[model samples]
Target: MNAPQVSPIGGLPSRGFAEPHQNKQQAAPKNDALVQIRCSKAAAKEVKRAAVEAEMTISEFMLVCFHAYMKR
Candidate 1:
């Protein structure tokens, strides 16, 4: 009787793809914190527009603005 062919490497089949964590979104940095701001709808819209124009997330734009204000 002919024996069935087997992989030389005996283990779980290798997935032809990246591991789950490799494809996952990066975890937030340890030093980062979430801050919520309360504002009127008009103010929110203005901030969103400014962030978009600056090509930054609102948090990044706000941090830049805060640093600038601190330097003044």
Candidate 2:
């Protein structure tokens, strides 16, 4: 006889879990705005590397930098 695989959080099988957020139309809040930035290839690569080092998404890192600039 084979035993069923269970989820780490509960006895329910992993496949039984429902991810409601996945079905949502929008991931971010309505008040949040989007901004686009264009940079040279070298600058883009440096930003990606810095974001990784800071353990943040590229967007998060950019927001942090922007806020710091605004405060100065």
Candidate 3:
């Protein structure tokens, strides 16, 4: 007996075996809402640093923080 091959991406089955969802189009959601924050130059720099440390974009970092706040 022989084992099937796998794709490096998504750990999905390869060799003509594809899931239905995998074939569907995936798009980024539209940004319909906006929130603005004002801060000093130092504060802005700190936010940038923190976002980088967390390996997320500035927008992602902000959303994560906002979600955490809402959960509390």
Candidate 4:
């Protein structure tokens, strides 16, 4: 038996993301406040729910959540 095949989405570049922590010399704001990270589907749903319950923007809720993590 042959393995199943998957087709690519049209006209997209390959390997869209780069290695992290490799471009410290790049231009960026000193107080940049946003970051992006990959999360599992379940984790993403939970974050959204928590943010809504806290009546916070996603960024604010994430900052609060992360601070709570660091405090532990």
Pairs that collide in candidate 3 are none
Candidate 2, residues 1-72, lDDT tens digits: the string is 999966667765566667578547577568666555567999879877888888997678878878855676
Among these predictions, the greatest TM-score belongs to: 3
Candidate 1 lDDT over 6-63, as tens digits, reads: 8667576876986567435466446566554567999879877878887997678878
* Model 3 lDDT per residue over 1-72, tens place: 999975578675555855667435465466787655567999879878878888997678878878865676
TM-score of each: 0.34, 0.36, 0.38, 0.36
Judged by whole-model lDDT over C-alpha atoms, candidate 3 comes out at 0.74
- Model 4, span 1-72: residue lDDT tens: 999876777755776677667466575548766755667999989978877887997678768878866676
Q: Give the winner by lDDT.
A: 4
The 0-to-1 C-alpha lDDT of every candidate, in the order given, reads 0.73, 0.74, 0.74, 0.75
Stretch of 10 with least lDDT, candidate 4: 20-29
In candidate 4, stretches whose alpha carbon ends up further than 4 angstroms from where it belongs are 1-35, 65-72
lDDT at residue 9 of model 2 (Cα atoms): 71
Candidate 3 weakest ten by summed lDDT? 20-29
lDDT score, candidate 4: 0.75
lDDT of 1 at 17: 80
Candidates ranked, most accurate by lDDT first: 4, 2, 3, 1
How does model 2 fare in lDDT?
0.74
